[model samples]
Target chain A: LAKTTQPISMDSYEGQEVNITCSHNNIATNDYITWYQQFPSQGPRFIIQGYKTKVTNEVASLFIPADRKSSTLSLPRVSLSDTAVYYCLVGDGTHNTNAGKSTFGDGTTLTVKP
Target chain B: EAGVAQSPRYKIIEKRQSVAFWCNPISGHATLYWYQQILGQGPKLLIQFQNNGVVDDSQLPKDRFSAERLKGVDSTLKIQPAKLEDSAVYLCASSLDSRLAGRTGELFFGEGSRLTVL
Candidate 1:
Protein backbone atom coordinates (compact mmCIF):
# COMPACT_ATOMS: atom_id res chain seq x y z
CA LEU A 1 0.00 0.00 0.00
CA ALA A 2 1.26 3.48 -0.85
CA LYS A 3 1.07 6.12 1.85
CA THR A 4 -0.66 9.34 0.86
CA THR A 5 -0.42 12.90 2.18
CA GLN A 6 -3.00 15.64 1.66
CA PRO A 7 -4.10 18.91 3.15
CA ILE A 8 -6.11 18.70 6.34
CA SER A 9 -8.59 21.30 5.23
CA MET A 10 -9.28 23.72 2.36
CA ASP A 11 -11.69 26.62 1.99
CA SER A 12 -13.25 27.87 -1.24
CA TYR A 13 -16.03 30.14 -2.41
CA GLU A 14 -18.99 29.12 -4.53
CA GLY A 15 -18.53 29.07 -8.32
CA GLN A 16 -14.74 28.92 -7.91
CA GLU A 17 -12.61 26.02 -9.03
CA VAL A 18 -10.99 23.98 -6.28
CA ASN A 19 -7.98 21.78 -6.56
CA ILE A 20 -6.68 19.26 -4.00
CA THR A 21 -3.32 17.59 -4.34
CA CYS A 22 -2.11 14.33 -2.87
CA SER A 23 1.45 13.09 -2.53
CA HIS A 24 2.33 9.43 -2.85
CA ASN A 25 6.05 9.34 -3.29
CA ASN A 26 6.22 5.58 -2.96
CA ILE A 27 3.57 4.75 -5.50
CA ALA A 28 4.05 1.47 -7.31
CA THR A 29 3.97 0.86 -11.04
CA ASN A 30 0.65 -0.89 -10.97
CA ASP A 31 -0.95 1.46 -8.50
CA TYR A 32 -3.81 3.68 -9.62
CA ILE A 33 -4.82 7.02 -8.20
CA THR A 34 -8.37 7.13 -6.87
CA TRP A 35 -10.30 9.99 -5.28
CA TYR A 36 -13.38 9.67 -3.13
CA GLN A 37 -15.70 12.28 -1.64
CA GLN A 38 -17.52 11.77 1.61
CA PHE A 39 -20.35 13.91 2.90
CA PRO A 40 -21.35 14.25 6.54
CA SER A 41 -22.52 10.96 8.04
CA GLN A 42 -22.24 9.17 4.70
CA GLY A 43 -19.94 6.75 2.98
CA PRO A 44 -17.23 7.88 0.66
CA ARG A 45 -18.29 8.10 -3.01
CA PHE A 46 -15.96 7.51 -5.89
CA ILE A 47 -15.24 10.65 -7.84
CA ILE A 48 -12.50 9.83 -10.31
CA GLN A 49 -9.62 7.46 -10.97
CA GLY A 50 -6.64 7.48 -13.26
CA TYR A 51 -3.33 5.75 -13.91
CA LYS A 52 -1.46 8.56 -15.63
CA THR A 53 -1.83 11.82 -17.47
CA LYS A 54 -5.38 13.11 -17.21
CA VAL A 55 -8.81 11.58 -16.85
CA THR A 56 -12.01 13.58 -16.85
CA ASN A 57 -15.49 12.66 -15.77
CA GLU A 58 -18.71 14.52 -15.41
CA VAL A 59 -18.07 15.19 -11.74
CA ALA A 60 -14.33 15.86 -11.58
CA SER A 61 -10.95 15.43 -13.22
CA LEU A 62 -7.75 13.71 -12.14
CA PHE A 63 -4.30 14.76 -13.26
CA ILE A 64 -1.34 12.49 -12.72
CA PRO A 65 2.13 13.59 -13.65
CA ALA A 66 4.56 11.27 -15.37
CA ASP A 67 6.58 10.85 -12.19
CA ARG A 68 3.44 9.56 -10.44
CA LYS A 69 4.74 10.97 -7.17
CA SER A 70 1.65 13.13 -6.79
CA SER A 71 -1.77 13.77 -8.28
CA THR A 72 -4.43 16.46 -8.13
CA LEU A 73 -8.23 16.43 -8.09
CA SER A 74 -9.91 19.38 -9.77
CA LEU A 75 -13.49 20.35 -9.04
CA PRO A 76 -15.11 22.88 -11.36
CA ARG A 77 -17.54 25.56 -10.23
CA VAL A 78 -17.76 24.49 -6.65
CA SER A 79 -21.01 24.87 -4.75
CA LEU A 80 -21.95 24.97 -1.08
CA SER A 81 -23.12 21.39 -1.31
CA ASP A 82 -19.61 20.38 -2.37
CA THR A 83 -18.47 20.61 1.23
CA ALA A 84 -17.11 17.22 2.19
CA VAL A 85 -14.02 15.21 2.98
CA TYR A 86 -11.92 14.06 0.03
CA TYR A 87 -9.65 11.04 0.17
CA CYS A 88 -6.87 10.13 -2.22
CA LEU A 89 -5.71 6.55 -2.32
CA VAL A 90 -3.08 4.81 -4.46
CA GLY A 91 -3.17 1.06 -4.84
CA ASP A 92 -3.06 -1.78 -7.30
CA GLY A 93 -6.61 -1.62 -8.57
CA THR A 94 -5.74 -4.38 -11.04
CA HIS A 95 -5.73 -6.90 -8.27
CA ASN A 96 -9.25 -7.42 -7.07
CA THR A 97 -8.27 -10.22 -4.73
CA ASN A 98 -7.26 -7.72 -2.06
CA ALA A 99 -8.54 -4.42 -3.35
CA GLY A 100 -11.22 -4.12 -0.71
CA LYS A 101 -8.59 -4.05 2.00
CA SER A 102 -7.08 -0.81 0.77
CA THR A 103 -6.22 1.68 3.47
CA PHE A 104 -7.83 5.10 3.78
CA GLY A 105 -6.02 8.10 5.23
CA ASP A 106 -7.53 10.87 7.35
CA GLY A 107 -8.57 12.67 4.11
CA THR A 108 -8.80 16.37 3.18
CA THR A 109 -11.79 18.30 4.44
CA LEU A 110 -13.15 20.74 1.84
CA THR A 111 -15.34 23.57 3.07
CA VAL A 112 -17.32 25.21 0.30
CA LYS A 113 -18.45 28.55 1.59
CA PRO A 114 -21.61 30.29 0.41
CA GLU B 1 -31.74 -0.57 -7.43
CA ALA B 2 -31.74 -0.75 -3.64
CA GLY B 3 -28.41 0.01 -2.02
CA VAL B 4 -26.78 -1.87 0.78
CA ALA B 5 -29.00 -2.13 3.84
CA GLN B 6 -28.01 -2.06 7.54
CA SER B 7 -29.96 -2.40 10.72
CA PRO B 8 -30.33 -0.71 14.12
CA ARG B 9 -29.14 2.67 12.88
CA TYR B 10 -28.05 3.37 16.47
CA LYS B 11 -26.97 1.25 19.39
CA ILE B 12 -25.97 2.04 22.96
CA ILE B 13 -24.28 -0.46 25.22
CA GLU B 14 -22.21 -0.50 28.39
CA LYS B 15 -18.66 -1.69 28.67
CA ARG B 16 -18.25 -5.47 28.86
CA GLN B 17 -21.53 -5.93 27.06
CA SER B 18 -22.17 -7.46 23.68
CA VAL B 19 -23.59 -5.89 20.54
CA ALA B 20 -24.25 -6.90 16.98
CA PHE B 21 -24.80 -5.22 13.62
CA TRP B 22 -26.33 -6.63 10.47
CA CYS B 23 -25.93 -5.87 6.78
CA ASN B 24 -27.51 -6.89 3.49
CA PRO B 25 -25.60 -6.20 0.34
CA ILE B 26 -27.04 -5.36 -3.05
CA SER B 27 -28.36 -8.31 -5.00
CA GLY B 28 -25.74 -10.29 -6.92
CA HIS B 29 -22.83 -8.42 -5.34
CA ALA B 30 -19.87 -10.65 -4.61
CA THR B 31 -17.74 -8.59 -2.23
CA LEU B 32 -18.67 -7.29 1.20
CA TYR B 33 -16.69 -5.19 3.68
CA TRP B 34 -16.93 -4.05 7.26
CA TYR B 35 -15.35 -0.77 8.26
CA GLN B 36 -14.97 1.25 11.43
CA GLN B 37 -15.14 5.01 11.33
CA ILE B 38 -14.11 7.09 14.30
CA LEU B 39 -15.25 10.68 14.33
CA GLY B 40 -13.01 12.99 12.31
CA GLN B 41 -11.13 10.13 10.73
CA GLY B 42 -11.43 8.02 7.59
CA PRO B 43 -13.00 4.64 7.71
CA LYS B 44 -10.76 1.67 8.59
CA LEU B 45 -11.34 -1.70 6.95
CA LEU B 46 -11.99 -4.34 9.56
CA ILE B 47 -12.85 -7.26 7.35
CA GLN B 48 -13.65 -8.23 3.77
CA PHE B 49 -15.71 -11.11 2.54
CA GLN B 50 -15.97 -12.61 -0.92
CA ASN B 51 -19.12 -14.59 -1.20
CA ASN B 52 -19.30 -16.23 2.23
CA GLY B 53 -15.55 -16.55 2.38
CA VAL B 54 -13.18 -14.38 4.33
CA VAL B 55 -10.71 -12.47 2.20
CA ASP B 56 -8.94 -10.13 4.63
CA ASP B 57 -9.29 -9.72 8.36
CA SER B 58 -5.83 -8.63 9.39
CA GLN B 59 -7.15 -5.46 11.03
CA LEU B 60 -10.05 -7.08 12.81
CA PRO B 61 -9.72 -7.55 16.56
CA LYS B 62 -10.56 -11.22 16.47
CA ASP B 63 -10.44 -11.52 20.22
CA ARG B 64 -13.39 -9.21 20.58
CA PHE B 65 -14.79 -8.65 17.13
CA SER B 66 -16.12 -11.22 14.70
CA ALA B 67 -18.08 -11.09 11.43
CA GLU B 68 -19.72 -13.59 9.15
CA ARG B 69 -21.28 -13.51 5.71
CA LEU B 70 -23.27 -16.68 5.25
CA LYS B 71 -24.93 -17.63 1.94
CA GLY B 72 -23.01 -14.79 0.33
CA VAL B 73 -25.79 -12.29 0.89
CA ASP B 74 -26.38 -11.01 4.40
CA SER B 75 -23.66 -10.52 7.00
CA THR B 76 -23.38 -9.97 10.72
CA LEU B 77 -20.70 -8.36 12.87
CA LYS B 78 -20.52 -9.06 16.56
CA ILE B 79 -18.52 -7.55 19.38
CA GLN B 80 -18.13 -9.13 22.79
CA PRO B 81 -17.15 -7.26 25.92
CA ALA B 82 -17.15 -3.98 24.04
CA LYS B 83 -14.86 -1.19 25.19
CA LEU B 84 -15.00 2.57 25.04
CA GLU B 85 -12.79 2.72 22.01
CA ASP B 86 -15.18 0.42 20.20
CA SER B 87 -17.72 3.20 20.06
CA ALA B 88 -17.85 4.22 16.41
CA VAL B 89 -19.91 3.92 13.26
CA TYR B 90 -19.85 0.48 11.69
CA LEU B 91 -20.11 0.66 7.93
CA CYS B 92 -21.07 -2.07 5.48
CA ALA B 93 -20.12 -1.85 1.83
CA SER B 94 -20.56 -4.09 -1.19
CA SER B 95 -19.39 -4.17 -4.76
CA LEU B 96 -20.66 -6.01 -7.77
CA ASP B 97 -17.32 -7.71 -8.09
CA SER B 98 -13.76 -7.40 -6.95
CA ARG B 99 -12.19 -7.66 -10.39
CA LEU B 100 -10.44 -4.61 -11.73
CA ALA B 101 -12.76 -3.89 -14.63
CA GLY B 102 -15.70 -5.58 -12.97
CA ARG B 103 -16.60 -2.55 -10.92
CA THR B 104 -13.35 -0.63 -10.51
CA GLY B 105 -13.63 -1.17 -6.77
CA GLU B 106 -16.70 1.01 -6.60
CA LEU B 107 -18.41 0.26 -3.30
CA PHE B 108 -21.99 0.93 -2.30
CA PHE B 109 -22.28 1.49 1.41
CA GLY B 110 -25.17 1.46 3.81
CA GLU B 111 -26.08 4.28 6.19
CA GLY B 112 -24.09 2.46 8.90
CA SER B 113 -24.75 1.50 12.50
CA ARG B 114 -23.64 4.02 15.07
CA LEU B 115 -22.57 2.40 18.32
CA THR B 116 -21.99 4.17 21.60
CA VAL B 117 -20.23 2.35 24.42
CA LEU B 118 -20.99 3.79 27.81
Candidate 2:
Protein backbone atom coordinates (compact mmCIF):
# COMPACT_ATOMS: atom_id res chain seq x y z
CA LEU A 1 0.00 0.00 0.00
CA ALA A 2 1.18 3.52 -0.77
CA LYS A 3 1.39 5.95 2.10
CA THR A 4 -0.17 9.38 1.77
CA THR A 5 0.63 12.67 3.48
CA GLN A 6 -1.85 15.52 3.88
CA PRO A 7 -2.50 18.49 6.11
CA ILE A 8 -3.64 17.77 9.62
CA SER A 9 -6.30 20.46 9.57
CA MET A 10 -7.70 23.27 7.43
CA ASP A 11 -10.26 26.01 7.96
CA SER A 12 -12.57 27.59 5.43
CA TYR A 13 -15.47 29.97 5.64
CA GLU A 14 -18.85 29.20 4.19
CA GLY A 15 -19.15 30.01 0.47
CA GLN A 16 -15.40 29.77 0.05
CA GLU A 17 -13.56 27.11 -1.86
CA VAL A 18 -11.27 24.69 -0.08
CA ASN A 19 -8.51 22.54 -1.50
CA ILE A 20 -6.82 19.72 0.39
CA THR A 21 -3.66 18.27 -1.06
CA CYS A 22 -2.18 14.83 -0.48
CA SER A 23 1.37 13.78 -1.27
CA HIS A 24 2.26 10.22 -2.12
CA ASN A 25 5.75 10.28 -3.55
CA ASN A 26 5.95 6.52 -3.75
CA ILE A 27 2.69 5.98 -5.57
CA ALA A 28 2.70 2.99 -7.89
CA THR A 29 1.43 2.86 -11.43
CA ASN A 30 -1.58 0.77 -10.50
CA ASP A 31 -2.46 2.96 -7.54
CA TYR A 32 -5.51 5.19 -7.67
CA ILE A 33 -5.98 8.39 -5.74
CA THR A 34 -9.15 8.18 -3.65
CA TRP A 35 -10.57 10.56 -1.10
CA TYR A 36 -13.01 9.78 1.69
CA GLN A 37 -14.94 12.12 3.97
CA GLN A 38 -15.74 11.19 7.53
CA PHE A 39 -18.03 13.08 9.88
CA PRO A 40 -18.00 12.81 13.64
CA SER A 41 -19.01 9.32 14.78
CA GLN A 42 -19.69 8.12 11.26
CA GLY A 43 -17.77 5.87 8.92
CA PRO A 44 -15.85 7.45 6.10
CA ARG A 45 -17.65 7.93 2.78
CA PHE A 46 -16.12 8.05 -0.69
CA ILE A 47 -15.91 11.53 -2.09
CA ILE A 48 -14.11 11.13 -5.40
CA GLN A 49 -11.43 9.05 -7.09
CA GLY A 50 -9.04 9.51 -9.99
CA TYR A 51 -5.87 8.12 -11.43
CA LYS A 52 -4.53 11.29 -13.03
CA THR A 53 -5.53 14.66 -14.41
CA LYS A 54 -8.93 15.81 -13.15
CA VAL A 55 -12.22 14.16 -12.24
CA THR A 56 -15.26 16.08 -11.09
CA ASN A 57 -18.32 14.85 -9.33
CA GLU A 58 -21.41 16.33 -7.79
CA VAL A 59 -19.70 16.82 -4.44
CA ALA A 60 -16.04 17.49 -5.17
CA SER A 61 -13.24 17.43 -7.73
CA LEU A 62 -9.95 15.57 -7.79
CA PHE A 63 -6.85 16.85 -9.58
CA ILE A 64 -3.81 14.68 -10.11
CA PRO A 65 -0.75 15.94 -11.81
CA ALA A 66 1.12 13.88 -14.37
CA ASP A 67 3.74 12.96 -11.81
CA ARG A 68 1.06 11.24 -9.74
CA LYS A 69 3.12 12.11 -6.70
CA SER A 70 0.30 14.24 -5.29
CA SER A 71 -3.37 15.08 -5.69
CA THR A 72 -5.82 17.68 -4.54
CA LEU A 73 -9.45 17.53 -3.43
CA SER A 74 -11.37 20.69 -4.17
CA LEU A 75 -14.67 21.54 -2.51
CA PRO A 76 -16.60 24.46 -3.86
CA ARG A 77 -18.73 26.92 -1.92
CA VAL A 78 -18.25 25.08 1.30
CA SER A 79 -21.01 24.91 3.90
CA LEU A 80 -20.75 24.45 7.64
CA SER A 81 -22.18 20.99 7.21
CA ASP A 82 -19.07 20.08 5.23
CA THR A 83 -16.96 20.12 8.33
CA ALA A 84 -15.36 16.73 8.58
CA VAL A 85 -12.09 14.80 8.28
CA TYR A 86 -11.02 13.98 4.74
CA TYR A 87 -8.76 11.03 4.03
CA CYS A 88 -6.59 10.47 0.99
CA LEU A 89 -5.72 6.90 0.14
CA VAL A 90 -3.58 5.32 -2.59
CA GLY A 91 -4.23 1.77 -3.64
CA ASP A 92 -5.07 -0.56 -6.48
CA GLY A 93 -8.84 -0.26 -6.53
CA THR A 94 -9.02 -2.80 -9.32
CA HIS A 95 -7.87 -5.64 -7.14
CA ASN A 96 -8.38 -6.73 -3.52
CA THR A 97 -6.87 -10.17 -3.29
CA ASN A 98 -4.58 -8.94 -0.53
CA ALA A 99 -5.15 -7.76 2.99
CA GLY A 100 -4.24 -4.50 4.70
CA LYS A 101 -5.52 -2.48 1.78
CA SER A 102 -6.92 1.03 1.77
CA THR A 103 -4.60 2.31 4.47
CA PHE A 104 -5.85 5.70 5.69
CA GLY A 105 -3.60 8.46 6.91
CA ASP A 106 -4.23 10.80 9.85
CA GLY A 107 -6.49 12.72 7.45
CA THR A 108 -7.06 16.42 6.93
CA THR A 109 -9.73 17.77 9.23
CA LEU A 110 -11.54 20.51 7.34
CA THR A 111 -13.46 22.91 9.52
CA VAL A 112 -16.08 24.86 7.65
CA LYS A 113 -17.11 27.92 9.59
CA PRO A 114 -20.16 30.03 8.93
CA GLU B 1 -30.87 -0.65 -1.02
CA ALA B 2 -29.91 -1.26 2.59
CA GLY B 3 -26.46 -0.14 3.75
CA VAL B 4 -24.01 -1.91 6.01
CA ALA B 5 -25.50 -2.29 9.51
CA GLN B 6 -23.52 -2.45 12.78
CA SER B 7 -24.44 -2.69 16.45
CA PRO B 8 -24.60 -2.06 19.39
CA ARG B 9 -23.95 1.53 18.37
CA TYR B 10 -22.05 2.19 21.58
CA LYS B 11 -20.32 -0.01 24.17
CA ILE B 12 -18.68 0.70 27.51
CA ILE B 13 -16.75 -1.93 29.43
CA GLU B 14 -14.05 -2.20 32.05
CA LYS B 15 -10.53 -3.36 31.43
CA ARG B 16 -10.17 -7.13 30.94
CA GLN B 17 -13.83 -7.38 30.01
CA SER B 18 -15.01 -8.70 26.65
CA VAL B 19 -17.22 -7.01 24.06
CA ALA B 20 -18.59 -7.92 20.67
CA PHE B 21 -19.93 -5.98 17.70
CA TRP B 22 -22.13 -7.23 14.87
CA CYS B 23 -22.44 -6.16 11.26
CA ASN B 24 -24.73 -7.01 8.38
CA PRO B 25 -23.67 -5.91 4.96
CA ILE B 26 -25.90 -5.17 2.03
CA SER B 27 -27.38 -8.17 0.36
CA GLY B 28 -25.19 -9.91 -2.24
CA HIS B 29 -22.04 -8.07 -1.26
CA ALA B 30 -19.16 -10.56 -1.22
CA THR B 31 -16.45 -8.64 0.65
CA LEU B 32 -16.59 -7.38 4.23
CA TYR B 33 -14.05 -5.56 6.36
CA TRP B 34 -13.53 -4.59 9.98
CA TYR B 35 -11.71 -1.38 10.88
CA GLN B 36 -10.75 0.35 14.12
CA GLN B 37 -10.73 4.13 14.29
CA ILE B 38 -9.14 5.95 17.18
CA LEU B 39 -10.16 9.43 18.20
CA GLY B 40 -8.71 12.05 15.81
CA GLN B 41 -6.97 9.37 13.72
CA GLY B 42 -7.89 7.54 10.55
CA PRO B 43 -9.36 4.07 10.62
CA LYS B 44 -7.09 1.05 10.57
CA LEU B 45 -8.02 -2.15 8.81
CA LEU B 46 -8.30 -5.08 11.19
CA ILE B 47 -9.54 -7.76 8.85
CA GLN B 48 -11.03 -8.50 5.45
CA PHE B 49 -13.19 -11.39 4.35
CA GLN B 50 -14.29 -12.63 0.96
CA ASN B 51 -17.26 -14.95 0.87
CA ASN B 52 -16.96 -16.32 4.35
CA GLY B 53 -13.20 -16.82 3.98
CA VAL B 54 -10.50 -14.70 5.48
CA VAL B 55 -8.69 -12.68 2.85
CA ASP B 56 -6.45 -10.58 5.05
CA ASP B 57 -6.05 -10.37 8.82
CA SER B 58 -2.47 -9.18 9.09
CA GLN B 59 -3.42 -6.21 11.24
CA LEU B 60 -5.81 -8.09 13.54
CA PRO B 61 -4.55 -8.38 17.10
CA LYS B 62 -5.15 -12.10 17.17
CA ASP B 63 -4.18 -12.21 20.80
CA ARG B 64 -7.23 -10.21 21.82
CA PHE B 65 -9.38 -9.52 18.77
CA SER B 66 -11.33 -12.01 16.69
CA ALA B 67 -13.81 -11.64 13.83
CA GLU B 68 -15.85 -14.01 11.74
CA ARG B 69 -18.22 -13.87 8.79
CA LEU B 70 -20.34 -16.96 8.40
CA LYS B 71 -22.30 -17.81 5.25
CA GLY B 72 -20.71 -14.68 3.81
CA VAL B 73 -23.49 -12.44 5.07
CA ASP B 74 -23.33 -10.99 8.57
CA SER B 75 -20.21 -10.84 10.75
CA THR B 76 -19.01 -10.35 14.32
CA LEU B 77 -15.94 -8.71 15.85
CA LYS B 78 -14.93 -9.45 19.41
CA ILE B 79 -12.38 -7.96 21.77
CA GLN B 80 -11.39 -9.73 24.95
CA PRO B 81 -9.53 -8.28 27.91
CA ALA B 82 -10.12 -4.84 26.55
CA LYS B 83 -7.65 -2.11 27.38
CA LEU B 84 -8.09 1.63 27.69
CA GLU B 85 -6.32 2.20 24.40
CA ASP B 86 -8.95 0.03 22.74
CA SER B 87 -11.50 2.79 23.20
CA ALA B 88 -12.18 3.45 19.56
CA VAL B 89 -14.97 3.11 17.06
CA TYR B 90 -15.14 -0.15 15.17
CA LEU B 91 -16.30 0.34 11.60
CA CYS B 92 -17.72 -2.26 9.23
CA ALA B 93 -17.56 -1.84 5.48
CA SER B 94 -18.51 -3.98 2.50
CA SER B 95 -17.71 -3.90 -1.17
CA LEU B 96 -18.47 -5.89 -4.24
CA ASP B 97 -15.74 -8.07 -5.62
CA SER B 98 -13.68 -6.02 -8.00
CA ARG B 99 -12.75 -9.17 -9.90
CA LEU B 100 -16.15 -8.97 -11.45
CA ALA B 101 -15.90 -7.58 -14.95
CA GLY B 102 -16.26 -3.80 -15.23
CA ARG B 103 -16.66 -3.38 -11.50
CA THR B 104 -14.61 -0.92 -9.49
CA GLY B 105 -14.10 -1.61 -5.82
CA GLU B 106 -16.05 0.84 -3.69
CA LEU B 107 -16.48 0.44 0.04
CA PHE B 108 -19.83 1.04 1.75
CA PHE B 109 -19.34 1.82 5.42
CA GLY B 110 -21.72 1.49 8.35
CA GLU B 111 -22.38 3.96 11.16
CA GLY B 112 -19.65 2.23 13.25
CA SER B 113 -19.71 0.81 16.79
CA ARG B 114 -18.16 3.06 19.41
CA LEU B 115 -16.32 1.25 22.21
CA THR B 116 -15.03 2.75 25.43
CA VAL B 117 -12.98 0.57 27.77
CA LEU B 118 -12.87 2.07 31.20
The C-alpha stretches of model 1 lying farther than 4 A from their native spots are A92-101, B99-103
Local distance difference test scores for all models: 0.86, 0.88
Error of 1 at B66 (Å): 0.5
- lDDT per residue (tens digit) for residues B12-77 in model 1: 999999999999999998889999999999888899898999988999999999999989999999
Q: For all the models shown, what interface RMSD does each have?
A: 3.0, 2.4
Candidate 1 clashing pairs, residues 3+ apart or interchain: none
Total clashing pairs in model 2: 0
Give the poorly placed runs of model 2, Cα more than 4 Å off.
Answer: A93-100, B99-103
Q: Tell me, what's the RMSD of every candidate?
A: 2.2, 2.0
- For model 1, residues A60-81, the per-residue Cα lDDT tens digits are 9999999989999999999999
Query: Against the hidden reference, what TM-scores do the models get?
Result: 0.92, 0.94
Worst 10 residues of 2 chain A by lDDT: A92-101
